[model samples]
Target: MAVGSVALAGTVSGGEFANPHLCQKGQQLLLYFRTIYGKQILAGYNVYPHTPDDYQQTGRHAAIWGRDIQWLGDVDEVIAHVQRHGYILTLHWHWFFGGDSAWTRERKTPVVLDQLLKPGTPEHDTLMRELSKTADVLEKLQQAGIVVLWRPLHEIDGGWFWWTDLQHPENTAELWRVMFRYFTEERKLNNLIWVYSAGVGDLKKKPPEWRRRFYPGDQYVDIAGIDIYGVDLQQDETPYWDYFRAMEEICPGKTLALCECDAIPNPDKMVAGKTPCWLYALPWWGCPHPRRSVDWARFTMGHPQVITLDELPLFDDASYAPELGILRPADDGGAWFPNSVPVIEGFVAGRGSPVDLLQFLVDDKVVAEIRHPPRDFSWTWPGDLHGTFELTARAYDAAGKQNLSNRIHIAVGVRNAARSRSVRASSGTNPEAAVDGSYYSGWHAAKDAEDAWIEVDLGSPVEISQVNLIWGWKIHPAKFAVEISRSAPDDSERSWETVSLLEDLPWQPWKATHRVRFAPRIARAVRVHAYQRAAHQTWAGYDLAEIEIPIPAR
Candidate 1:
């Protein structure tokens, strides 16, 4: 399925839809994001009713220019929302020249199309001014240090959007050049990076002249991109790869991006890391409207790569895990980014100090919470802990008192260790802060025995989708695997349950990265072990550079 020939999904047998927007993915770009999009991207509304359905079918994720984009009342609502809750606002500009087709089918009312398509009129100038007004917003946001991946009039070669039928490819290209040159080159807006896109199916089919016409010129473009929403790709074996091959041939050396993509999942399986410079990836908004599912919360947090506008910063943070109740909190001065709350479990160690803890997200929202020390028996939070200087206990079942644990409410501030502690993922850089004084433990080593491996405290049982194993001699036959047991960190004799393994790579100064995904299984702690041998003796040592923990579906 090399993409020279792509079968249309909704077409009849022997009939092919050959317009070039069909998606055959090449490399899965890891994008990280959140579920919220608001005022920051208000300009996207210029495209009109920029509905989620439009996003799926047309590849327009809201960069519009119109007076109606913002609510008349209080614009601060969106501004405060992002500041307090860590919601992301994506900036996108889409083409609107075509009369609309299948994806837009009967949805973009004719009235809307008329307004968008009517170029060179007073009304259009006013529209342009309105869009330009969003510049004020972008400038202000830049001062605030918010990053925007500004994509304007994307995928020109497809001939479906506004660039259609424009005289002289240079004229359309000039339009693009003027936009950024005026905004950045002249205006000195350095924070904005351009994403140049095209969805024209096969590069071979394009005559040199036509392909040349599609480009807005390389000077203004920063990132090469494409948009693909497949209807029947899941039915095929290699749906996305072939689609990417088409773009790869067209763009040649430039990195191809999923400008506005959600055609498939498990992009990590397709594109592993930054080696080939797959660079930045941000998927379309989480189903833009009520059509968005709650599961999007999981999708936003679980995938190591994919991110919504809301969770964009998490990719740079590298530690936020939404599953364990930790979330990417908006930057709180010097506080560790991406907080977590206590993730409750059905069981806890009785007659023991609580090893569990709480962490927050980037938004500083309560992601999870753990009742640090068990109440010496099975107990639940019967009421809010607003202690009146003493502890209270109540029994659930007096008839079976032996089986029931009494409810206990005690003042917690003096014992809340989290007040002075930091929530973070385990790493070599954090050896002192590595263990939370928790009971769980396992070992992970780096290049050798002295490489210093620390057992990650899982805090609680969780299913992990993928684990990153890095740093080992590629030529070495050393095989690495993780072992899990109910064993405490101090004890090495506890029974171990081996789960995942890592294959050694050609050890370079920068280790070749590998992503290992498996069915989600709950484990409290994992030990990474690498098997190696020497002449006349056999030895096992572990080496790692970076590790990415992806959570699978529950």
Candidate 2:
């Protein structure tokens, strides 16, 4: 196959299969994920809950529920219930053989791929028996007219599974092909939608090259997926977006899915065009990870963009599908100073389709056409242009199918006066570090102090509209007041005017950036007065990684 020659699933309708050439389906079923479902993401969960209605705490059932086939006694009952309720069904198998679990052999004594494929060998026999058993269950589902999103040999390159061998991608691909043929041709199980899932490799590595190594080809896959767990969605979603783009290039016309996840990403962010559109997400079952809670689940399930079980449509709806979202400048928009070049970024979804041209538009005019791989989804504006303008993007595939991004309005000539400015704090310890433009260093207040304050001198009176406080690692002030003064900071008799009184800051135990925007004001000095520290904070005083003051115009 050519690098990006395959036609994408952009034109396929929701709930329908893709053309057989794209995969085994007649029409792209998950094309809707990047189109209609782009605005309505399918939320799912793994395994059943202890209590029948435990997940109802989110006020609704997920659109799909996945399970390890080994845990169920009667797969038919579960299949019937899922199908009867109009919910999607997904299943996986953790093969146990020779007293070793699926994850027990890869590192120590891995299953040799070649031996497993050689029919007469013991390894081959073991695989055939397991495949037969799994096929029998799938055959039952097929007989019952139930469609399954089946994930077998998941995370093939993760090195945790018995079949994994990063150096021999061809072997992994062959293993998948063998299973694909056994289940589809021999067993004649047509109800399964094959999902090829990759593992989230080293947390620090965000490139997609490693994932592409394990791909078994488009003919053997209906959906390309990745398993995400333990990563805090509250922090940054860049890694997920990066992989989302990676998978699209790896399998140009396959539906992209989150086979397994820990935290359910915020749908609001998706609606705001901050992340890629996934076909569906199945969060691991049971106790919520610390990053996720019932409240968060409720928020995700209840959001209009997040489609729960009841929200799924009865029939296929294709109309038009395209998922191009502007992830930079934010959906809320941004303001930059004149002569400041801003980076524009976006996400393209829908069967991990390849983008031929990602054109950055300003007020409907093409500013730049990003032709290279959107590794970071980043494109720097060529010139330092200033003024309020509407921003949007258009991504065209090889077939010229267009995916339009969400539009945002941004203004230039907004300067950050606090950058490299004279800053001081009550602690009198390296106060300048807070405005040093480095998140690595911060200023901490006096130990066990009842109060703390950090002030910045803007050099000259500038109209400041926003103040961004980058909280230090796990430390933030619960209550703080932003005060401005027209007089010099050293003046003992200078009067300070309270501009904004912020309180009850949420406990987001991470280095998070919080923004406070107020009516534009001209002030020579701005200071933050901290009262109570955030809950569970072990530090004695308020700490800040960096502070930014954006003046709408000088």
In order, candidate lDDTs are: 0.37, 0.67
Q: Which regions of candidate 2 are displaced past 4 Å? A: 1-37, 48-54, 105-109, 203-207, 287-291, 315-554
Q: Candidate 2's C-alpha lDDT? A: 0.67
All candidates' TM-scores?
Answer: 0.39, 0.52
Against the true structure, candidate 2 reaches a TM-score of 0.52
Clashes of each: 59, 11
Tens digits of lDDT, candidate 2, 265-383: 76767777788768788887532334456456656765677766534543222212223555555422123435567777645533233556778888799888878445347777665
Q: Taking the tens digit of each residue's C-alpha lDDT, what string does model 1 give over 316-424?
A: 2122111111121111111121222212222222111122433212112233333443322222332332211111222111122111111111222112212222222
* Highest TM-score against the true fold, candidate: 2
Query: 513 in model 2: Cα distance from truth in Å?
Result: 42
